[model samples]
Target: MNSQFWDEKFSLNPNLYGEGPNEFLKEQLSIFAKGKILFPGEGEGRNALYAASLGWDVTALDQSYIAQKHTLLKAEDSGLKLHYLVCDVSHFIPEPESFDLIALIYFHLPLSIRDNVHQTFEKSIRKGGTILIEGFGKKQLKYSSGGPKNEEMLYDIHEIKSSFPNIQWEYEFDGIIHLNEGKGHSGDGHVVRLRGKIK
Candidate 1:
């Protein structure tokens, strides 16, 4: 989907996906202290603002002005400040050894662009930086929950291992999650969750 599609989708409802962070992300963060974080494709800024509340310096990047609008608005409402940027992920290069944490929650891209973006992510992360990602797994089709319908976009643990071979997998798995958010995603869904540290 392009910016127009996303812009229209976000414009249709101001709080389309509700105002909260992902459950799994919250649970995972419980074990570690927050730090400088980069959130790629951070739609509506839920995760970024949440991280900011936890004392993480968050930089959220996305191509949609609609997304940045909601993100900045929500940040202001929550009394949290987040650095929001409008940029395409495929070419948004970051300085190496920059961030202590990187998040890619529910962000998926076409195969042709994914590799380069992933490469940038791999190179930009500090040696000890952690990456947290959550996305629909192939089994999500059975649940019919919100996500891209394309099976190719869905990822598995083995695929992730192969894709980021240099990252040490601290945790990676697939399981069902109950999502009660107001729009787009609501119900039990199968998803892949991963945590890795630069090696």
Candidate 2:
């Protein structure tokens, strides 16, 4: 995947996922005190912008330059600011304990680099901080609702748990759920959700 693919898609529609943040992410953030948070693979910055508006120090990363542009424009429109970076998740290396939270909403990656991405992100969160993830489950391929068509890129509970071995699970779910985030993610789909603290 290259920036051009995303640039054209985003250029066609700014609200690919929607203008609002993920509903699951919004609900999960209520329990945490605002602090430094990172959103990896953050496309269009909906979640990051929402966190910024809520007074959280937000940093967003994505591979698409056009995506960053759209997100920053939205941030400006909302009177909010966030540190947005255009970088590939596979190559990103965050400083140790740099984030109070790492939110991965639909942050799917290729299997070749998924493990490394998880390992890199694991060291970025401070002790007692949270890693919240919500993405389509393996069964989502049955639906046309937004998600990778490739089964390998979809979420698997066991593989995900193994990725962040130090996580002390606080909440987890894997089953069918109705989604209405935008035209991209609408209707019933199988999804996995996890909220946990790193030991």
Model 1 TM-score (2 dp): 0.95
Q: Write the per-residue lDDT of candidate 1 for residues 1-199, one digit (tens) a residue.
A: 8888888888997666667888878887777777788989888887788888988888999888998998898788879988999987877989998988888888888777876788788888888888888988888888856888887777776876567766898887789988765587789998889999999
* Global fold similarity of model 2 (TM-score): 0.97
Least accurate 10 contiguous residues by lDDT in model 1: 157-166
Score candidate 2 by lDDT. 0.91
- Model 1 gets an lDDT of 0.83
Q: Per-residue lDDT for 1-199 in model 2, tens only?
A: 6668888888887788988989899998888899999999898998999999899999999888889999999999999989999986777899999999999999888899888889889899999999999999999999888898889999999899898988898999999999887788989999999999989
* lDDT on C-alpha atoms for all candidate structures: 0.83, 0.91
Q: What would the TM-scores of all predictions be? A: 0.95, 0.97
